[model samples]
Target: MFSNWNKWSIIVFIIALLIISPILTIFYSAFLGDTSLWPHLFSTVLPRYTLNTLILMIGVGSLSLIFGISTAWVVTRYDFPGKNIFEWALLLPAAVPAYVIAYTYTDLFEYAGPVQNSLRTIFNWEGAQDYWFPNIRSMGGAILVMSSVLYPYIYLMGRSSFLRMPISFYQTGSIYGKNIFLTVALPLSRPAIIAGLALVLMETISDFGTVDYFAIETLTLGVFNVWLGMNSLSGASQISSVLFIIVVILLTLETIGRKNQRYFEKSSGQNISSIIEAEGIRRLIYSFLCFIPILLGFIIPTSVLLNFVLKGFAVINFQEIFSAMFTSLYIAIISSILVISVSILMITVSYFRSNKFQKFLIFISSCGYAFPGTILAVGVIVFVGLLDNFFKFNFNYYTGGIIILLFSYTIRFLAVGNGAIKSGVTKINPNLINVSKIMGFSFIKILRKTIIPLIYTNIFVGVTLVFVDILKELPMTLLLRPFNFETLATYVYQYASDELLEECSLAALMIVIAGIGPVILLNSAIKKTGKIRKSEPLIY
Candidate 1:
């Protein structure tokens, strides 16, 4: 029946199936599970898991705001030494994965590591008991590591909002004796800040890596333990369902909060807000504050990696490393295109379809990003297993399949693509579509000739960002790869699993290198888009 519909309808259905499959699988398993186990879970480990997840979310959320918002404010509002470098450098941490940072931190701070050894030599300390250092494998360490890298999400969004604000707002705040930072900037940018924080929180909740490395007893870890340790995929699915519920609730709250508050520049005269120059001691302190996040996020870990590479201590497997890099790039590119295209289609349909049911369906489709990658991979496996079995019973297919994993990745990464494209589309005046309609253009024609051309750059940036994200993805790829596929992320995880990080440095660094292309492209696109928007003169 849908065959008569436009190509977009087919596209939407296909993408919807991809997004819904894993969720349906989880729901199926939840129904099948002997949830007599729930009582035991609640009595035993569930409370601790919930508590740890909450603490991690709160800690990382607050710290990332401090790191992300402060630097964004300073760079956008004030002119100081190194301000130019800090504007871009603050984003470098996004190129590094939280898990990779966790591994690097562990190596640098462990008992046999150089920091403790150097201190031992200097202080003539005897052993572990002679002097004390906080273990890097703790909750606090996970917070520090995650916040270091994840703050870039906030910084990106927060900086964009801060830069787009009209100078008149700040001027009015100054006249009213308001603290601009606390009263004007913060309140004005709350939507963007909350959106960024929502992304960070979803990432933190769905994170299996940092928590696993730190041995934090969070819900994600519990999901894994229940699935693999208890040999029960159903129990695992039930837990993942819980995680999904938490994410849905948070996203819902965000949507509700922003429902009544519209953030846009009403008087658009291409006004550029002039930066305030800091003088003397204040300037020095501001520079120091701006330096801290990037220092911890990029410099330290990168310096350690460089040391390993330069000391000739790490062997470079050029052939194997090159092969993994190629594989990673190919997969990232393919998945990125698939994800961004699907996201744009979904967002477009949601905006123009005018049917509430269709809009809600599109919204639900993007929600798959909330699942932890490994758990979602399992859902894909279970769902595809059922599909393959049915096909074999009727026609002839099997559990091991190819498109299954790609479908999973699209489901898992669509939210990032959706968020990016949605942000861009939101900036455009909705009346443009109405004007096109009044000019006798069909919806698809208007979308093709108008909306697509207008948001083409956002689509590109979204694809590139998703490409980089896929390049760094580990758990889903690990669980879902065909018999012998190896991406850089999986390659590094294997050796790093054995605590042989020196051996995996090439692959680990390759993940960063794979990301650099997309990161550069994204920054350039964002900068160019801002410039174009700024150059357009406003009408009275």
Candidate 2:
């Protein structure tokens, strides 16, 4: 039967090929690697890398949960002064890349920096050993920096869950003389919080920038160390495979825990959720809590960059920075469009078709984001090498040597798109599709008329996320881009890799500025959708 299936099959095949090729290359490399090295890895670098990665994950995970869930609960439930602004402001950190934040924070908080210098002069201290200060280039610092920017993933998801809850649950808690916030809202939002936590953990595990900057030696760091330091792509792929195993286990546990659980809104009429109003002291505390994250995530890093920009010593070539900014914007926008469109298509098909193989394929495709971008980029390089060789021999043709890097980006970033779209699909009621089908609407018609409009906010969320990810991308772009091609990320990384951050401050600042537009627009769209959903029935 000719249906959307025929059309979708062709698209899905291309996407699946692009998504799976790098992984296949990594697997082949791993299979061919010397097993003798595994024992040495276990005895030497493996334990330290695994322990540090686990510690960082636990630390960042705990902090992000606290910051994300508490702030989400406070803002969604209570009406305090500036609560309206806090709703969107809490999301600002989502715009700042963790690596850029790391660079800015290092400049601001290092011992030779203004704060320490002021302390030394005031306290009459002498040399390096005069007093103790916390190091921003350590594991603890990595956790702090990562949590500051990453918690918004949880916050956005948690708050949406909180706002959707029926008021009757809170009223029932109040009737029983229970703490409504803790007893009613938190429990109801647990699934969402976990989902957000899952995203945070995946991002943390895949993170290379903060760990590399802090010298924390995560699994991702090990992948780079093994590949570059040991000159063994096979060994690097082996390490990446281990990281991938951990992610699969974690995701499996989360899925099992959620198997029998449900979050469907009750169908009873007039189920409006009530907003709690805070008093004087409570209002001040809530507002302060909300501001703390912004202070750490955005204000501090931004202030430091601004300071350096103002300093005559921090020289910047404005024309060079502008060109880099344009390149970054162009690549980020194009890549985001591709990722989001493909994600929406995959998610819609996987959800409605109920085919086990297709579902598994999509799941495997998204796991790409769990691997370090650098490692994945290497896999892409190997795969591309093979493809180019085959093409040159068979078709007497060569790959668009430059364009393949962009394809590699699509492979790496499909997860951000798939995650957002899948979450959107999960939130929708399946009955809507059945109803549409019963009404004689074709699958494509139902998708175009019902699903697309229903999930446009999700598409934007995925777009904004992929855009920022591409903006901050470094190692992958560095290795994969055409010779002489420099996006802002690569431009900044050149100076940053050499620790000449001041020289690249303008490019870094441009990344943040470029991100600002999408961040604001996505936040607005999410909030608008939530408001509309609140008043409407719980129809799919």
Candidate 3:
């Protein structure tokens, strides 16, 4: 037993260390007495970057909660005209990448866009000083674009929590003549709401493409500006360290909040059908409430992209687009497989064999998901630079290759794979493993025969999620991909960055298309997992 434990311990330790190396490199580089550029950055753009980041976070978080929680509550608590369609249709936006949405919105609302053009023609207005119009490249636009796609995180988690609420609670609220939604549902769903908000906020902070195109001077944009514009990796690392600390603080608050609050209820053996059904005007209102999000999130942007593709069909490059599509698919597949394997191995060993300290290390290793991708990419660059300097080797030879890109993806996305597998792992009976062990089965044999089969559903869920995420990934791929390498993301980014959405519309559409299937599969898996959990007998 001691030998087996040691073997697993060593493996888990190595995996955790590799996962955290880039983050550690960022911190290490930040403190290397790099003060030359700090003064310049502080005096010039740091404050603006910090302010923009805060505003973006606040705006995106607030709007996403509004969109996500409202829609989730309505769907779970009441039966509306299109409640069934809205339940799944609301999730479609999750398939669209934020950058792609940003591009489509820009294409549809910019000064020369079709909407503005039509309005001018109809109203007989002139060029420069036409009627008032909202600029789709401002901070407000960033919030709208981000919230449209990101709200699903909140919706998915919040709806699940609401659905799992014991019917007795609603009955009691009715007896007291209290508003069930405000008095019972909202308070109980706090954890899920916070969890989803945390994801949205983290993704908001990590975003680069949307902010870059909009020219919003957020911290993520500042990280890139410092790295590339000024050629100061240390300064960039310092900024990244600040960003890392900010995320750590946010996550710490979330953890502390969760620890202080707990919701418990006896099962009523009733599903969401027990909730009152909306009728007539109420039903129409509920349907419209859900429709607004779907329209802004998926339909309008998709229509715009489709329009671009239609208009540019004659000039669209099938060869290069297909080539990029194949590349994106290939990398997404390989990286998802590699990430899921590592996540399962690390999470399993941590759960079964590790000490408290080892478990803590494992927890911290997943913190990469909280860092902005551009910052994380910079960390990878710094780590690789150290390796190159120590070994006197050209690390660029590898950094410019697919291997580094995959490693970066693993670092950035390990959390997704880990979270899915860990949730599945917790539901598993430890006795099954102990029984296998008592039969003189090897640890590997136990895992293969028992654990793997039980967690196959979760493994698929994680794989699908990681694959879609990789497909839509932009910053890390843009920074680390090999010369002449073009994923669908980078391919679209080239044209989108230049505001030539018409040319890259087909490629951008393909990214969303690739993700749609996986997104649906993931949502189904989550729903199935929730149902299975609810059906299980409480051991306590």
Candidate 4:
């Protein structure tokens, strides 16, 4: 028994150390003081980057909340025309990457594009000063494009929380003559809403493609500019440290905000509230409200890409694009497997066998999710560079290779897998493990025969989410891919960055298409899990 305990303890320690290595490397580089660029950055661009980052976060967070919560409430509480379609359709945007949407929007709305050109022809204006037009490559444009794609995080969480709430809560609010939504639903759903908003904000802060494409001077952009342009890895690390601190604070606030807040419904036998069907003008309004987000988020961008493909504008290289697509799927599958396996082991040890110090290490292991991808990629570079230097071996040869890329993905996405698995772990009864042990079942035997079967749904969910994320992942793949490596994301980014969307529309569309299957499967798994739990007694 002691041997088994020691074995798992050492395994968990090593895993946590591996996960936290990059973060430590970044902090070490930051304090090395090798660069003299700090003063210049402070005087010129740092403040602008900070301000732009804040504005982007606030704008995206607010808009995503509004879009996600409104749609979630409508879908859960009220029935309208095409409500069934909207139920799953709202999640379609989650498959569309923010960067792809940015490119498609730019293609459709830029001066030489269809929208502006049609406007010019209609107004009979011949010059630049003919009329006013909104630029799709500005900060505001970044917010809109990002919020449209990211809002589904909030919607999924909010809808789930609403579905789980007992009907009694709403009935009580009605009896007290309070607005059920404002008084009961929103407050009860605060934790879920905040959890989703936190994810949105993290994604916004970590985004490189949209902000870079729009030429927004956010800190993420600043990281690359300082690293590659100025030849100052240390300065870049320092900037990343600042961004890292900001995300940590946000995450901490989210945790503290939920402290001492708990919800309990007295009755477990009550069903959730029935949906109210809309009629007449209300039906039309509901339909339009639901239609707007899906149109902006999924339909419009998809149609624009389809138009590009149908018009024979996109560069067709079926052999090369197909090779890249397969490569992407290969890596996503392998990395998802690796991440989920490690996440299960670590979470199991932390929950069942670890002391305070070990648990703290597990917590640190998950912090990589809070760092921007580029920053995390840079951290991996620094850490690997040190290893190469210590052993007098070259690491650059492997820089863009699959080995490094997969390692980076593991570090960046471990938190996602951990969260999904940890939630599943909590639902399990501890006494079952004790019983199995008393029956002479070893830890490994219990895990394989008992725990694994029970958590299969969560494992599938985690794998699907990580797979979708890696498929659409850009910044890390951009920085760390092998010299000739080109995933679907990097493929689209190459042409999109050059403002040659016509050349990459097919690839861009493929990324969205690839994510759709996994996302739909994930939602289905979640719904099935919810149904199973609904039949059981409520537990905190």
Candidate 5:
């Protein structure tokens, strides 16, 4: 059937197959072992795990919308005091991981912590009988923690949508004595909100650190427990299949958003006019609105970690910490380079050379990112183990699993690289690729000589972002790393899980610091969004 396909198309298809092979292995491995565990799982842990996962997704999704949509609307709609500062500062929380924030909140709100202690001092009450305080380890707490860090996805997307909407829409709402937000802005911004919410929900379901630390028993955590606690690989894969279904639905939501995005494309280059001039009480309210999410997501957690570092700075374990830091940086850098290389090849071919089937395959391959890290790790391990068995080499998990890490990381982050490459490719002259083809140059030669140089900036952006993501990654690094190997993320996880968070505070802080670069880039991009006008082509 494919005999007429060009070499480039075949090559792209094979790469997509390699990228999707692990996901295939996951479904295959689910049926390989005992079939009896399914009843037990469904009766006991599976129902609870599934319910908790849904609840977490709903809770986090709702809260992220409130935080993200509220802040986006406030910053874009009202001219409040400190409005300029809030635009960029609101994104700071994206730098902190959910698990890190969970650790910080646990200390701040626990029974023996300063908050309860202060309350006790004021009310002259003592011990556990005094009053009821919310547990930071409960379902509600998990929602709060996850939402704080994840809301930036919605904020960024929604704000861009709001800015792009025609001012006439809001003006019409106002002329009719309607709330512009409810009547116009919110309605027009639904696609962007759903897109962002899909991302937030995906992050919520994929989370292992916060759910695991809080003992919430989400499906992601169930995969972990079933695999390690019960030593049943098949059982883990079955749970991962459920998580896989959730991911597919989220992808559908994203697709719907993307399809409708063109409908709201900015029609005019005019700036969005602020409807409300925040002053006095309104200014205070709007300012406080922006402050809360920032306070919860970035400030409190960062401050807690900073306090720990300051107190422990003298006796910090510089040797071990430095080693783990180097390891994390090394793996992240190498994995980013590989991901970008494949991304450039696949995206260039898909856009410039490949047919529809090849483009579809390439697109499908990038969906690896939608899988939870644990689910993807299980898939990768099963696939790699099969390869090891067939090859009969000394490449077991104990000795040579770095290859597994690299492979899995490539799959997990390839979408980030592809997005960047696609953005860059869109701006280049398509005639350049055609001219090379007319001269009888192969696709590879044209790609090397023409496409790569034009996209260097985008390549740098993709690699930098992916490197930071891998640096902060926990589930895959926790489960699939070579024996005795540790990244800074795993290092922080180990110490924090043992209630020695102070020991790992420095490493955790470093991860947060590295993430700030992406925030800076995003802020710069947002600044330029509606400012410059594209010159119309005279030929068109």
Candidate 6:
């Protein structure tokens, strides 16, 4: 197999290694140093961090599933008043970073914040001791804020999966007097739903902003505490190793969930799904339930930020923030392009030309997405620092040259690109590729003329997702960004950190605003994919 490997296989193999080098460096650093600190770490904070992390993952996962699946189910199955609005509005929270949600909700629900202030006004309560308002800085609060922002991952995947489900399956279930959700929809969409849930769980465990803000001692926060506070890179790498293990477990579960996929694969050209029209109270109930997530995720926080902007505009330097916005757009756009380019090459090569071992390496390369951004940043810094001894180059050359940040973004977001393209590629008939090869079409020509044109929608979606993710990314930008360089995420985080979130409201709003196009485009893409799938059935 090794002797027979072609140029495409070798090239993709190298790219995969380069992509995952940072992650490999993390493991290298963990075992490279003395093992003395392990005892103290385990004795003191490790168990607590592990417990908090597990608890947070479970809480956020459950809540996000409820919000994501329920809303997705309601929209896909039931026709209601706000179905159209909810279709896209439900995805809005994805634009808001978990930390920003943490900041905004605290402002709204805290003792002196508007919610409690109004409560005090209405009930004439005096101080914190007099009234027992829920602390928005607690573990529960962290789960709530993170769930609100992260559910969109599940929602997007679930909705797309639901939309892609064949109508005949539902009709057959109806004839058998089966529960559509349990008997049909759930089974067919389980793989996609699980993939989405895995992404959500990974996002939850890898989160820094929400956990840090709430002072929750998850593994991610523990990484920072050890790295920055205790000044132990080895200990930080150790904790990051734990996070990496968790990501592996989640990815394995995702893989397991994808098993028996052949059983659910329908070889039908009819891609239509039946939407039930709810009558009277059922309609109202469906509409109300669907709106709950949008309220928690998008409406409330956006309102708070908008209020902040209205009040603090006089103090804001629009010039500075706008400059940062352009910089963010530039970097995000370029980085997303690079990530998608690599994703197309790797996934196509893996799917078509590579052996199983090489394919596994390509797959593992995307594990970067599930690592905490700070942890990934550490890996990048370490990996680059090692190279700098010979290459005489560093990640932070200057603001004008932010190549390292672009590379980091590529590593972090390559999974999104891969997932998008994979979804498209899998839908393509294998016969098409076989016939192309039979006609003496080279791999490059087939990919360019056949795969790329066919999967342009997936490519577009991948680009949009990576672009938005880069814009909303915080920890990496905060760590790896050069001095005097600011993205919208860092801008919002800076002011939010200083308890002056109002000052950077416009930037925060822009981050949310930037995603609106993508969300709408996503909605359109799902609808469009459904139509496309009708014409192209699974070839058994």
Best by lDDT: 5
The segments of candidate 5 whose C-alpha lies over 4 angstroms from its true place after superposition are: 1-4, 264-276, 396-399, 440-442, 532-540
* Candidate 1: segments with Cα more than 4 A from true spot: 1-11, 257-272, 312-314, 341-356, 393-401, 418-459, 525-540
Consecutive 10-residue window with the lowest summed lDDT within model 2: 393-402
TM-score of each: 0.87, 0.86, 0.94, 0.93, 0.95, 0.89
Report the Cα lDDT for residue 103, model 1: 85
Residue lDDT tens for model 4, 1-540: 223347788888997897799888998898875757677778998899999999999999999999999998888888888988888898999889999999999988888888988888898999679788989899889999999999998998888888777778888899999999999989988987887898899899999999989999899999989988888899899889889888888787667545623666555566467678887898888788888889999999999989888885545777877888998899999999999999998888888877778888888888787778988988999998888778876445654367788889999889999988998998889998889989999878988988889899999889988988898899898888877888999998888888777778888898888779866875775465346344454433
TM-score of 1: 0.87
Q: Score candidate 2 by lDDT.
A: 0.79
- Candidate 2 wrong stretches, greater than 4 Å: 1-11, 253-261, 264-270, 312-314, 340-356, 393-401, 417-465, 529-540
When sorted by TM-score, best at the front, the candidate numbers are 5, 3, 4, 6, 1, 2
Best candidate, TM-score: 5
lDDT of 4 at 402: 75
Estimate candidate 5's alpha-carbon lDDT, on a 0 to 1 scale. Answer: 0.88
lDDT scores of the candidates, listed in order: 0.79, 0.79, 0.85, 0.86, 0.88, 0.85
Give model 3 RMSD, 1 decimal: 2.5
Q: List model 2 lDDT by residue over 1-540, tens digit each.
A: 233355565567567877888877877777675666687888999899899989998999999998998898899878999998888888888777888888888877798888889999999998679899999898888889999999998898788777677767777898999998788878777776777787788788888767777788888889889988998777887887788777877677556535523555565564557677898799999999999999998888877777767772437777777788887888888889988888888888878763666677778887777666766876886787778777763322223634666677788888889988988998889999999999999867998999989998888788887888788887688666766677898887777778777778777777777678766865776676456444455421
Q: Which ten-residue region of model 1 has the weakest summed lDDT?
A: 393-402
530 Cα displacement, candidate 2 (Å): 4.1
What is the per-residue lDDT of model 5 for residues 1-540, given as tens digits with 9 covering 90 to 100? 334377877887888998899999988888775667888999999999999999999999999999999999999888988999999999999999888999889988998888999999999997878788899989999999999999999999998888766666777788999988888889888988999999999989999999988999999999999999999999999999999999999999999987887543234444355456877798999999999999999999999999989988976798999999999998999999999999998998788777777888899999988889999999998888788789877766655779889999999988999998999998989998888989998877888888989998999999988999999999999999987898999998898899887889999999999999999988888877645343311110
Q: Write the per-residue lDDT of candidate 3 for residues 343-462, one digit (tens) a residue.
A: 888888887777777888889888777778888898898887787678877555645568788889999899989998998889988888788889999878878898889999899889
